[model samples]
Each structure stands twice: as structure tokens, then as C-alpha cells.
Target: MAPAHRDLADIIITDELAKRASEPPDYLREKLAFRDLADDMADNPKAVLPRLVRLAMEACGAESAGISLLEHEVREFRWFGLHGALAAFEGTRTPLDYSPCGVTLQQNAPVLMKHPETVYGWIRSAGISIPEVLLVPLHLRRPAEDGGAGTLWVVGSEPGFFSLEHVRVLTELAAFSSVAIRMIQAEEVVQAALQEQEQLTREMSHRIKNLLAITDGMLRLTARTATTKEELVAKMSGRFLALANANQLVRRPFAHDTISRVGLQQLMETILKPYERVSTKGLDVALGDHAINSMALVFHELATNAAKYGALSRDEGQVSVGWSIHDDRLEVTWNESGGPRVCQPETRGFGSTLIETTVRRHNGTIRYSWLDDGLTAAIILPLSSLAR
Candidate 1:
């Protein structure tokens, strides 16, 4: 019976039906039709694609039309901008491994399949009858093989429905769709980059403010307690070194530079190391490897202020830290005793700001009391956030 098909490299005439039903496409109408797509592409790129699907259907005089883009991450060809008989199946996800759209992209040309449902189980399962489908590849990404190719296709109303002219019109539309989609993707990338920059700005402002405050407080405390210029310089150097160590310990997550994990107990001990001694109670909590760097800053500021002017500055002064978990909340208490008569500062310093901000970031709260003998501070934080 010979081969029941007559085919070319990019064109396939499966049967005599395609020849019997030929009507050369109108070039003038094709030219006029692209105007709307161009206007939409310029005015609103997002709006152009659905119009493209509708235009492809209208221009080709097909029963249904849609666009399928290859998502390399999931290795799937997701259907978008559907129209006509199969419009209800919008947002359908088909595996890239076994799809005609994938084949069109792989072939890097237009593909005309006769009765595709006979071969593709998904099409048969979808329960829509397609006599023929004319697909044109959209090279959304260059080289196509690196996985950024897609397809714009129209389902024919009857067999042998597409001709060379139909292929030409669809091909032009597919090219235009490729440009519009690339523009849309570029705009999305810009938006995402802008959002990340905004977040980074906020974080930087907070860090700068806190760092200045910590340095200011340390200078004042070191100057007040230093017996001589040499002693003051030595004390300030030691304190600054300790602060750097604390910051470096928790810096990885912020810089996105490297990964490191420090336990809750370890962070507290390191930050409080500059002070003579800080007795830690209930410091054993398994919050896993996701450590909060902000907590390290809080403890450093607290212990720094203590060394400069609080209970830790005095010979007989003492500081004890204890924590308790109640339901979903963790409460930490800081008690100072055996020091000089204590009075709260008239102005709030950066240390206080750092403490309040860190607590608030975790949806937590902190309070301080100036007792006749010493300073007492209480912090309450969400255990869920801490554990995470």
C-alpha cells in the first residue's frame, strides 16, 4: 500500500485529506492581525500571550489553540493561554519527557501531526478529538536544547487542515510570542531583583545603627572604668575583639557566604566571655542547626553594657542568666546583684535598641527594672521561631 504518508523535512502530508481541503491563507488579513499583538506587546506584555493564542486560532481557522512552555526546573511542559474546545483544560501540566510540544522543540521546527490522540495517551485521556495539530517552536531561550523552548499550536477542525501558508502565519505568530514571553520573563527578573535589594537595604540599615550604638556604649564604659590611658586602650581592644568574634560566628546567614551552626549555649558563652563571668542556667535547648544570629548580637550588647557600667564592672558584682519554656514561649531572665547602687540611663542607647529590635523581630518582648541594688531584665520570645 506504499507508505500511507507523504512527508517533507518540516512538513508532513499524512493522507489525501489535507490536499482536498486546501484554501490558501489571506496574507493581507495576516498582516492586519499582527497589529493587535504588537500593540499588546508594547503596551502590556502579559496581556499579549492570551491574545496570541486567540489570534493563532483565528488566523489558522482552527478549533482550538494554546501555548505550552517547558519548565526546566520540574521538567514539565505546562499549558497556558488556552482557547476554544480545550479552553477548560488551562493550567494543565504534562511531562516534558513524552509530549509532542517537547518533540517540536527538540526538532527545532514546525510539526504537523495527524490524529495526535491516537499516539498520545494524554490527549485521548483528555477526551478531546483533534484531527490534526500544527505546532511551531518558540525559542524562548537560545539554542533551544538548553531547555527553554516552547510551542504555540492550533488544533485543526479536520484532517489535512494546514498548508504551507498556514505554517507561515503560525510560524510568524510563534516568533512574536517568543519575543513577548522573553520580555515578560525579563520584567519578572527585574521585579525579583528589586525586592531582594529592598530587603538587603533594610537589613544593612539595622546592622549599621546597632554597630554604632555598641561601639559608643563600649567607649563610654571603658573610659569610665579605666585607671589610665593604657588600661583604657587595652580594655577597649579586648572588648572590640570579643565583639568581632561574636559577630563573625553568626555572620554566615547574613552574608550568604558560608554555612556554620552554633548552639544556643555556645552563642551566649561566646558573647558573655568578655565580661568576668556570666553564670548560665537552663542554657541547654535543642533548637536544631537553624541558629538566630540576632540573638548573639542581643547577648553581646547586654553583656558589654554590664562590663562597662552594670554589675559586672564591680569586684563583687554578679550576673546570672536563666530561662524557662512555657508552652510555645521562651522567657529569659537576667539578674544583677552585689554591685553599686543602680539607676537606669536617662537616654536609650544602641544596646537597648539592639535588645528591643532583636526581641521584636521574633515577635518577642523585653522589659527592664532598675532596682535599688541591681538591674533586672526579662525577655520573652516565641519558642516556635527559636526552634526553627
Candidate 2:
């Protein structure tokens, strides 16, 4: 007799499982429309979930309705949002293996329990008299491989208070809840991407403004060094062009930081390229990315002076720039020849002062020799300043 009764019970449970697995006609139609409202709810889960719980309570005529999200790692269901009599239970946790919501999730259907305390003894121990509870599995719109979301439920204090009508209403709410949870997760990803883009925009803007300011300062200093209008324009134009080229090198795609190392050969070639009339040669050398603007400015001043009165001013003139690392120092030589006679300036000007300042800033030294044919300048920088 006992085996017969157990066999009959097993058959009843199988039939129940089959019924739960099948979707109701109304639910199928309702789920089709969930996609349209998903985007709207994605951005505002706090506002949407509360209203959803409220609507669920009103639609089902239940005393309480709430959404519980499964925290898989902790094996618990966390009450994300709630409405009606159980509103105070928000943020509370219940074991996934022991709660009514857990049973509904496991069965992948609506679980209607009479005297839930009979199974979840804590409900009785806590003195919370919830006699009847209805939970609907809130399956997320995730791929079937992900096992979907958790459960949403409506509980009442009176026995036999909930019916099939309540299940229908809660199922609809559960569908909506699943989409809402997915939307919230997507919204977070979108928000994070937007924040990163905003930060990059601000960083680029600041870098551009800083480059412009530096160019302006260079223009003013160039003005102080020129003896005539032609010299002023020429000097300013060369310095500006050099500054522009340096800015271009540092503005490579997705460069987040301000400081970038300019290669020694690359830097010299870029600065000298505009001097079309002069011949320029560069030798490869290792240089770190530090004080790039200052170093560029120093080379710009030297190149400008060459174009005006040194090697670059004459058709037969030529300039050779090279650097080598020696005993923890970087030695850069700028040798010029095949031009008109060279003479040292009588007074210290912006170009000379700028060169001095740049060298000092990098803890380096520069020496200029005004030869009979052209000027030769040698700059020595500490290896520490040139180490990447």
C-alpha cells in the first residue's frame, strides 16, 4: 500500500512538471512585446522595479509582491525590490535551497505554497505569519546556456488567498522583471563606455589647449629674439611649425597621457624637413620620452637660426644631426658647413636663452662654436633624463 501511494505521488509530480514547462497562450503573446519596453527600463531599474512590484500587487490583489534576484555565488536570493506589506524586506536574503522562491526557480514555474512555514521553518521562528505564498520563476532573457535569471513572487497572509489568476499576473510580471534585469545589466555596460569616452574627450581637449599655450609662449619669445620683421616672421613660423610637428607626434591615436617619448632621430628629421633648401642628415640614437616639448623647442631655435644666418641660409649649406649614448650621458652634435662666415651674437637673445633654459631643465649642457664657415653646437644630456 505504501509503494502504491508513493508511485501515485511520483506520477502527480511528473504531471505537475509537464504543466509548469508549458507556456500559457496569454503569456506567449505578452512576452513578444517585452523587447519594445526593454530599452526604456534598462536605464532606470530603481524606478521601474518599484512600480512593477506595485502594479503586480494591484493586478493580483495580493498583500505583497517583490522581486528576488539569485546571488549564485552565495547560494541565496536577495530581495532586490518589494511592495505592499513585505516592502520592508528589501535587501533581505533567503537561502536558495530553503525558500519558496528557490523551489519555484528549481521547478522553473509558479510555486503556490500553503503554510510555507511547514517547509521554511524560519518563517515561523521569525514570528512572520505568511500562510500562503506564490512564486513565479523570473527567467532572464539570457541565452539558454546561461540558465536565465531568478524568481519574483507575491505572498499573502491568508491561506488559499492566491489562485490561478494571481499566477497569471505574476508570470507576466516575472517576464517583465527578467527583461528589466537584463536591461539594467546592459545599461551599466553602456554607461561605463560613455564615461570612458567622456574622459578621453576631456583629456584630448586639455592636451590641445596646453599645446596652444606653449605655442603662444614660443611666439612671444621668438619676437624678442628677432632683429627685424622678416627675421621675426621666419623665426616664429619655424618655431610654430616645429611645435606643430611635435604635437602631431604626441597626438597618436588613443594616447591617454600627456608625456610621450620622442625618438632622437625622428625628432630631428621632423624639425629639419621644412628647411627645403638645406641638406639634413640624422643618425639613429636611443632617447627616452621626457621633456619632449622643451627638447623640440631647443632644436627649433637652432634650426631657425640656421635657416636665417647659418648653414640652411645658403644653397651649398648642409646640416648633420646625430646623437650617441656615452658613459650614462646622451651627446647630441649639430654640425654645419658649406655656408657663409659665422659670427657669435653680441647680445643674449630669446633663442640663446631658450637653448640655455632647455639644457638646464634636463640637467644638460650646450656649447656653441662659431667657426669661420659655420656654427657647431654640441648638447650633452644626462642618461637619466634620456632613459625611457
Best by TM-score: 1
What Cα-based lDDT does every candidate model obtain? 0.75, 0.70
Give the C-alpha lDDT of model 1. Answer: 0.75
Candidate 2 residue-wise lDDT at 3: 21
- Every model's Cα RMSD, please? 8.4, 10.3
lDDT of 1 at 242: 57
lDDT of 1 at 260: 46
**Residue 268 CA error for candidate 1 (Å)?**
11
Model 1 C-alpha lDDT per residue in residues 28-110, reported as the tens digit of each score: 87777788678778888999999999988988889999999888888888899999998999999988777778778777877
Residue 226 CA displacement from its true place in model 2, Å: 4.3
Regions of candidate 2 where Cα sits further than 4 Å from its true position: 1-193, 201-209, 212-216, 225-231, 252-262, 276-290, 326-329, 382-388
Candidate 2 at 369: error in angstroms?
2.9
